[model samples]
Target: MSAVYDTRRQSIALSIVVPIFNEEEALPALAERLRPILDGCGEPYEVLAVDDGSTDRTPRLLEDLRTAWDQLRIVTLRRNSGHQAALTAGLHRSRGAYVISIDADLQDPPEVIPDMLTLARADGLDIVYGIRVDRSTDTGFKRRTAAVYYWLMRRLAGSFVPAQAGDFRLLSRPVVETLKTLPDQQQIYRLLIPSLGFPSGRITYQRAERVAGTTKYPVHKMVLLAFDSITSFSAAPLRLATAMGAFSLVVCLAFLVWALTVYATGRTLPGWTSLIITVLFFGAVQLFCLGMLGEYVARIYTAVQARPTYGVARDTDEEQQ
Candidate 1:
């Protein structure tokens, strides 16, 4: 499974796309662990470090590392366009037969690359998902929320959406091209790729802790990611909203029946508590439905704009010329 790659080959066999934000603390260690694995593989590869408008020393560190390692390519974005956009940029730019997207945080082990490559080639798989078998390294809250997320996604996006699979995965050329063709304004590759119904395989790995730097994905970002995942992949959320509205209507009807009974029996209360509660409940239900509709509407609006998700400020490969 471990073979020497021919550097003289004109075509690149593999491309490792790493989405970096402020990963200055992790870059060196990432290269240390990642380069050896790539070098040992029997395919000529390039590591694409996408700088998502880092406000820290991440860009400078990437440049320094690239200076020493020619295989390291830097794709600097004009602004921080978020994780998914950074990934979209790298996937579009990567010119390899197979591309693997990973994070610079070193949580998803680089040691699994050869195995992923071997499995994909052996089985002729278009996608190889790196599933986290043990998430004990993650906080309890993180793990629980992640479990719920996968559960909802699988139920909504279909059971084919693998549980515990994040963005760490290998995509063959065909899969990469197919992803490129998608017109999604906000791409959630986790669901988007699996929905393609491509022949795929999964490799389980123990999830590790971040090597350095604060986590870019806080609670808010996780919520947003979940929102995007639900909206972009399935119309289930909208359906859920409709169901809630129907339930609210039923409740309102029941309340109306009760009020009529009270009025006919001459036992109607003068207190405003019941009226205020009813108003608040109905208002809350309406707002919830509207929010769900707004999410889809916002996506439609962005799609109509047809704006690029990310802009490349600089490319080391081009700069070399």
Candidate 2:
């Protein structure tokens, strides 16, 4: 089942894209486990180990692995593009009829890949989502935050977004081509994919602990990702800002009426506390609305500039020729 990239040959059946960032510790385990599952599928496949500007020994390790495993292709980015950008690079470059994007961390098992292919082929599905059914291995905080994220996304981005599905999923060639045409600056595939309204299926699996290395997605990155997801998918935040502004105006009018009545009755307070509080409240509302507007403006600027999301430092497959 060992397969290698042949430029003259027909298209590969499957391409497993693993976006790696400083994943030196996990590379060996990932390769050991991932290769067999893909190999056993009895298909001509290639594994695109997308190196997202790793600052560790990841680049060298991938090179060494490719020496032994010809199917392993190294697609290194010139800089550390974010996860979604790296994924975009892989998807755009993949030569497989079916593409599956998975993280280098083994939390989402590679074993389920064969089942995904079988299900897709038999059911004629264009997308197969790897749904997380049991997350007992994850911390309580992580689980809670994930639940909240998915819930909010469903409400705002539409209910098509599968809960607990991160980037582990399978997409057919047609879906991949469709994604390439999108002009999104921040690619949130979880929401973006489902929004396509494609023929889809799901496969459930229990989450597992990382095989090695620390997590790349820290709390701050998670927060940033949430913001990106929110801004990229929906205008709910801008609408919420509008509602806050209206509420603030109503409150200020009510206070103005109270102040006039107090002055007429000669019971007006001498202190400036109420005036300062009102000023601060209004100021905060204005600032919040401006910030929401700024987020959308920034996205427009990025789209107008048409800057490349990622730069490829090297493609080992291309070098081989």
Candidate 3:
């Protein structure tokens, strides 16, 4: 941290943080759209591009872009941490009166920066989320899964968590500073931002497709993110597991009563199918409860380890050349 950032460097009025991972194909196009928008914003701004150990041409492309774009800065991680960790690193490193986190794929447009800033100032808001009103570019499966994800998050985390909001949002200095102080190793901005309980505004946009390259957030990563979001924010899963266990007990007791009544009537039902079905049903319920409990335990295990979310291998700001 000491080597990368000069303590004497002046802070800007606004900072836009983009986490990059194997986004080589998208860098040039992202710059093309991003630079003008930042320049037009009327306030001093810097773009902190966090390179999460991209193995492609992304690092070189960033270096080349920085040579031309003075406001662009690079923070390279030692390894490829997940999307949230990269974002956490950028947010922690960024120094600005207001910080906005956007994606490198350009799906979350840069054109909304001015609007976010304006709304934040005009309405005296601490946070402004760039919500997507339309996502017709997404595939049907994606749309369905996303809807379910947001629904589950809201149900489990309470109504405070805003739906249809990604990491594309603006946070005031105080909010950003406060987030930095939180001890959680997993940083899910969607839940984290709304939980701040700040006066907030929203600017809706139609979500666009990637300008270039493949999507970094594949299905597996999405599952992990969903799991992290649930485990980090709410205890509803644990409660649900408990409820299921109780219901299973009730069902088992009812079955026992029925079996005893039939035997007492001297008409014993030879019910191997019923026994098999009952065994399977109870087994499934027990396994489901165990899996839910395991999710929480895994989170607790990670927390007790107290490992840093990410580490920097090198930073462009430190380079003298």
Global lDDT scores for all candidate models: 0.90, 0.92, 0.88
Off by over 4 Å in 3: 1-8
For model 2 the local lDDT of residue 186 reads 60
Off by over 4 Å in 2: 1-9
lDDT score at residue 129, model 1, on the 0-100 scale = 98
Better by TM-score, candidate 2 or 1: 2
- Give the winner by TM-score: 1 or 3: 1
User: How many residue pairs clash per model?
Assistant: 0, 0, 0
Which candidate number has the best TM-score?
Answer: 2
Q: What TM-score do all the candidates reach, one by one? A: 0.94, 0.97, 0.93
By lDDT, who's the top model here? 2
RMSD of each: 3.0, 1.6, 3.0
- Pairs that collide, model 2: none
**What TM-score does candidate 1 reach?**
0.94
